[model samples]
Target: MDTKTFGQTRLLKACAACSVVAALLGCAAPAAQYYPDEEQAIEDEVGAALPPGSAIVEFTTNSAAVAAFQQRVGDKLCEPDAQHIAARVRRREIPSEVQQNFRGLANFLSLGALAQIEKLPKTKIAHYPANQPIAFAATAYITDGTCGPLFLQFTPQAAKRYSLSMDFNGQSCRLGIREMDESTQTRPVKHSRWRCAEGFLGIGKPTLIGPDEIN
Candidate 1:
């Protein structure tokens, strides 16, 4: 080929390479942001029917609750607004504070966590009434999927009514409950056999909404 033609060809190839690199660099930020939205979409698809204000509370060994549990589970998870009421209970004073704090927790704890979660808007919804209590032993996994047993008790708020929803993650479990009823039990449903998506547990799988409750 002529020298002039060869020079022109090299210039065009260099321009094309630069354009491709620029395009890829431009897409990097958007691609990173898209993953979170993608995860949310997956969660919404799985958790679609979850009533507004519902949340996934993680109580790990690293959580403050571990220390508090030695004193009292109720106190450990108690909301700040509920502290006075919880103190009354520990002091063997009026138990009225117990119910108030219990109700407050459904809103307080959920809202606090939801605030830090991207995309979920905050709301001032009232707590459901205390329904029946469901107690169970669970294997709670870390973000890396390593897990250990955790004994948990879920008490549904009154206004919402109580129903249990479990999404399984191998031997681990993520537990959530709707309104509680007289049927709540102390024995946990066996979760070792169930396989659910990571981050979602109980009957809801990825979204955490029970299959029966979903459309």
Candidate 2:
């Protein structure tokens, strides 16, 4: 090729490379700001969920209550006749405060680590209740594999109602019910219907389903 033609070609290539770099930098800018903003929001929510000086009780894998609850869920999910029920029943949407807690906690873990969290045989329950007993638990599971926690808050009434909340990576669900067999001696004979909302780690639309429907 001629010298002039070669020089022009080099100049064009350099300009193209610069343009590509500029485009990448532009895209990265929003993400850089986005992460910090999200992190701050999460922190604010966590503070609200477990405020300063709030009392909390932690339950390990060995806890009989935790073991029974896990087995109860496992039995339903393993049933051959089990159906993939959509979140719907009494249909209680999760409070914004609870949603924020999951988002904040998950922000600290990567997708791979989240998956491992779900499948771990044991669950760690952190009970923090107001007016009634509230328990928050984390477990590892396979499916969309991720490490996420579940929240269960009981009501003070005689019938005893429960608000079961969970965040699976970005997938979140909150189920509310009047009662579930709390007896530790046996698996629940009857299923509890819950109204739930599913979305990205605490953000989504509400639906209804039985507690056994959660996976």
Candidate 3:
């Protein structure tokens, strides 16, 4: 390659790098209000532990990609504006207002050591209603994008510890739910495949829904 050609190649690479950095540092997404303040978080956390309440679910997503866990609001199945257990962006990537608003059960994530994480340094946790069967719509996203949301459901027992996980290997992803036994043992919970009466992959967004939800 001639010197001029080599210089042009370098310029192109530089522009691409700039675009990525701009997206990373400046393009953080909007987040929902999980906990309003410390006092409310405490009350909610305590209430969740009692019978006919929520169960503690520790989340450990071991993947370079970031994913979201959205619980159905009341009976609004597969609604776009569901409650976010974890926003699609990592906690490290969350904007300042979210940092101040969430605590206790909602204060489970605090990782910002890397501009882009290889994997979260440790597990992040969450609390969800356990009085009845619950389900979440999950979607994974990477530097490029990801396959669309799929459904995950389990009947969480009160006072029991639960841990959920997701793994994304570039081409595909996997989600798992387990009923944790006294914080020591984990047993997998199997259910019939999820049924969503409707589906939509946000166009031009980070998710591109496949023909089916399993990805």
Residue ranges of candidate 1 with Cα displaced over 4 Å: 1-34, 41-130, 140-145, 160-215
The local lDDT score (0 to 100) that residue 170 gets in candidate 2 is: 22
lDDT for predicted candidate 2 compared with the true structure:
0.27
lDDT of 1 by residue, 1-215 (tens): 11000000001223333344334333222211112212221111213244454432221121111111111123222111122111000001111333334433433434443123322211111222244432333332222232322233454443333322223333333333333334743232221111123353433323221212110
| lDDT digits (tens) for residues 6-75 of candidate 2 | 0000012233333443343232232111112122111011232544334332222211111112211222
lDDT of each: 0.26, 0.27, 0.47
Go through the candidates in order and give the C-alpha RMSD of each one to the true structure.
24.8, 21.9, 14.3
Off by over 4 Å in 2: 1-56, 62-130, 133-139, 143-151, 155-204, 208-215
Give candidate 3 misplaced runs (Cα > 4 Å): 1-19, 22-53, 85-122, 190-192, 195-215
Top candidate on lDDT is 3
Number of the top TM-score candidate:
3
Comparing candidate 2 with candidate 3, which one achieves the higher lDDT? Answer: 3
